[model samples]
Structures are given as C-alpha cells and as structure tokens.
Target: MPRLSLALSLLAVLVPAAYAQEAAPATSPKITVDPRAIVDSMPQQGTLLTGLYATQATIELCSVEAGEPATTAMNAHRRQLESEMRMDDATSAAAYAAIKGDVEKAGVDCAEGSKDRQQTAEVIAIYSGAGATPAQPASPMDPAAPAPSATPADPAAPATPATPAQ
Candidate 1:
C-alpha cells in the first residue's frame, strides 16, 4: 500500500537522524587520574621495585644461593628486567615530561602537595633533576646498581580507568 511505503520511507529517513542524535557528545571523555594519587603512589612502588631488583641481583651474583647455570639464568632474567625497567623509566620520564600541564590541569601544585604525593614526587623530581623542586643532593640510586621494571598483576588484562564519583 502507498501508506505502508510512505511509513517505511519516513522511518528510513528518521532512523539515521535519530542515531546521530543518540551518539555521544564530541568532547573526548575526560581522563580523571588524580595526578596527586599517582605522584603519591610512585615512590612506595618505585622503592619496592628497586629493593626487589637489588635482592634478585644479589642472589644471582652470589654462588651460595644458586648454581652456575641457575645463576646464569637469573642473571639473564635480571638483565631483561633491568632493560624493561629502563624502558619503564623512559616511559615514566616521557609521561612526567608532560606532567606540568596535566598536573596543573588535574589541580595539583608541583611545589607542595600531600605527604604521600611529596614522597613520590621527590623521586620523580630526582629523576627529572632539571631544576625541579627539592633538588637531588645526591643521586637516587647508585650508578653501579640498577632497578627492575614493574610486572603487571595480570598480563592478559587491559587496565581500566576508574569512573569518577558523581
């Protein structure tokens, strides 16, 4: 019938318009990391990572803990971890390179923040050491000793950002 065809035609035209209207607003979803939280967390996590790598290295290098072959394998793994840590450090540096803009936008003062944030930020401030606050009187780590990268809790996981509180 003509009525049926008209109805179909009208629906065909309206459907696309309706879908376009339903689509989300164009502004990219705001990423809501509390820069202070990240700044706070990094120090504790970084220190733990450094300690773990140092222990592993010590155990590997010592003859008492492992046999020659075992030591070799451990050394190899330790090297791999160190390499990964270097990559992570680089990534962290890159991430923090942009920190000033992001942190200020995220509403944190780079100079004085929370105690936890300060602790974490101190490490970064040391890592950066480009006239950042609380200048490093000494290097954070010994030149001869290196640290390891952080391994994920679940390798298969794609980390999901947390939803902001309403």
Candidate 2:
C-alpha cells in the first residue's frame, strides 16, 4: 500500500512536470530594423510624403521576389506610414495604385539579374536594416558634411546632379 501511494505521488508530479515542459511557449529569433537607414534611403529630391508612398510600392512589389524578410519589413513600414501619415483607407489605396502604376510605367522588373531587381534588393537591404551603417548627423562645421546645393526637385522627374557649391 505504501509503495502504491509513493508510485501515485511520483506519477502525479512527474506527469505535470513533463506536461508543463511540453506546454511552454517556444521563443522565436528577434528581428530588428533601423529606422534611420530606412529614412536615409528615401528618395531625397521629392516631398517626403511622396517618397514614403513610392517606398510602399517598392516594398510591396519587391517582397514578392525578396521573400520573408522583405514581407516582414514591408508590413512594419506600411503600418508606420499609415499611422504616421494619417492615411485613410481610400487615400492609402489610391496612393499605392498611383505609385505602383508609375513604377510599372517606368519598367521596373523584379526578375532575377535585372537592374530593377538590383535596385529592389538595395531597397530591401535598407528596409531590412541589414549591414546598414548608421547615418551621421550633418554639421555646419564638418567639411565632410554634404553641402546644400541648387538642385531641381520633383517627384516624377529623373535624377540630376546638384550644382556644385562655389
């Protein structure tokens, strides 16, 4: 009888311990993204709002080819844009469509080895915050800091070199 009670107590304790081990939640690897890198990589010539919209299109299109990390980054960035920009559903949809149409019109192809694919990869790297150097603050006293120039700025226009500071 004593042996039977000891066996029952051991069984009760051991079973629950084993079950608790099995029921414990699994930990997943953490993902980190650098906001500064993402912001620095935005198209500098346009209004920041327009650049963010275009970035959204880029992330959506490239994520199809770029896979999981891009998708994760895309979701994070999209949420940030929607919240920070205060985009209503209709406005967000319209902006996405317009920017995506413009990108397609510009012949962006996400296929392997294409120039567009390379650009997309670069953009994804920025979004992924992988191997991205931290952006240095611009200082007026720092000669290495980029000087302001008389540059024409337009969202739809092709990029042109800024005039050299005299």
Candidate 3:
C-alpha cells in the first residue's frame, strides 16, 4: 500500500509538471510581489509601520554597536506605530514581519547608522510616521551637556537668596 501511494504521488506531481511544460509560452510568472505595489496599497499608517520595520531591521544590523538610545528609539517607534496601525499585539507583530519581508525583498538595507537623526529615504518612503529618534549619548565636549553649577555647595544656605537670612 505504501509503495502504491508513493507511486501515485510521484505520478500526480509528474503529470502536472508535464502538462505545465506543454501549457504555456511563458514560464510560470514568478509569483514575486512588487515592493511599490505593496507599499502603495497599504492602509493608512502602513507606511509608518513599514518604517518601524525598517528601523528594527536597521537596529538589528547595527546590533554590534546598538546602545540604549537605539533600543529606546526602536521601542518608542514600535509603540507609536502600533497605536497608529491600530492592530492588536499579535496582528501588529505579523504586520511588522510582512513589512520586514517586503523591505528586504526590495533590497533596501535598514542596518546603516545615521550621523544625524534623519531616517533614510527608503525607510521614510515606506513609513514616514516616526516622530522622533532616540537621544544619543551626551558628547564630552557637547555644549548641550549641562555644565556644573557655578555656585558652591552650601547645605546651610537659605532656601532662597532673595529671602533675608531668617
């Protein structure tokens, strides 16, 4: 019985292959998806979702140097994208997976780091809903880093200098 079943299955496969070979001038149209078509047909906020995927993919690629900021940025983007996409956790996760697949299939690399906070066109084109990037570490020489207070510490000082020493 096993042998018969095996033979039938082989015959079934072969018959279809043979018929397919004879049936068309064109080879089977590759069932490939067009990145543009996929992006264009997405529902509102889909682009942002794709951007989220791009960000995740980029962060993963940059994992060797990924720091707290990158992680925070990725998380924040995810939350916003989730809210905008209006999907439950599981569904949003699946949607992100699909976006990753589509972006990868289109040969867009998401792993490169930005000197500045601006996202790449490929990322933006697919999803422009990113409100902000994560905060990077304060540079040692960066003026943005707060300077130490000029005033000397005095625990006994009054609550306010404006008030008399009461």
Top TM-score hit: 2
lDDT of 2 by residue, 1-166 (tens): 9999999999999999999989998889899997666464544322445655565576567664555676687677676766676778898788778888898787667677776655556666666667434345868898877778767566579887789999
Writing each residue's lDDT as its tens digit, candidate 1 over 103-127 gives: 3455542243555344443333333
Q: What TM value does model 3 have?
A: 0.38
Segments in model 3 whose C-alpha atoms lie over 4 Å from true places: 1-44, 61-64, 108-166
Candidate 2 wrongly placed segments (more than 4 Å): 1-64, 132-166
**Quick one: best lDDT, which candidate?**
2
Write down the RMSD of all candidates, one decimal each: 22.2, 22.3, 23.6
Question: Taking the tens digit of each residue's C-alpha lDDT, what string does model 3 give over 129-151?
Answer: 44344348778798877787877
Pairs with steric clashes in candidate 3: 47-127, 58-110
Cα shift from native, residue 1, model 2 (Å) = 99
**lDDT of every model, 2 decimals:** 0.50, 0.68, 0.63
Q: Which RMSD does model 2 reach against the true structure?
A: 22.3
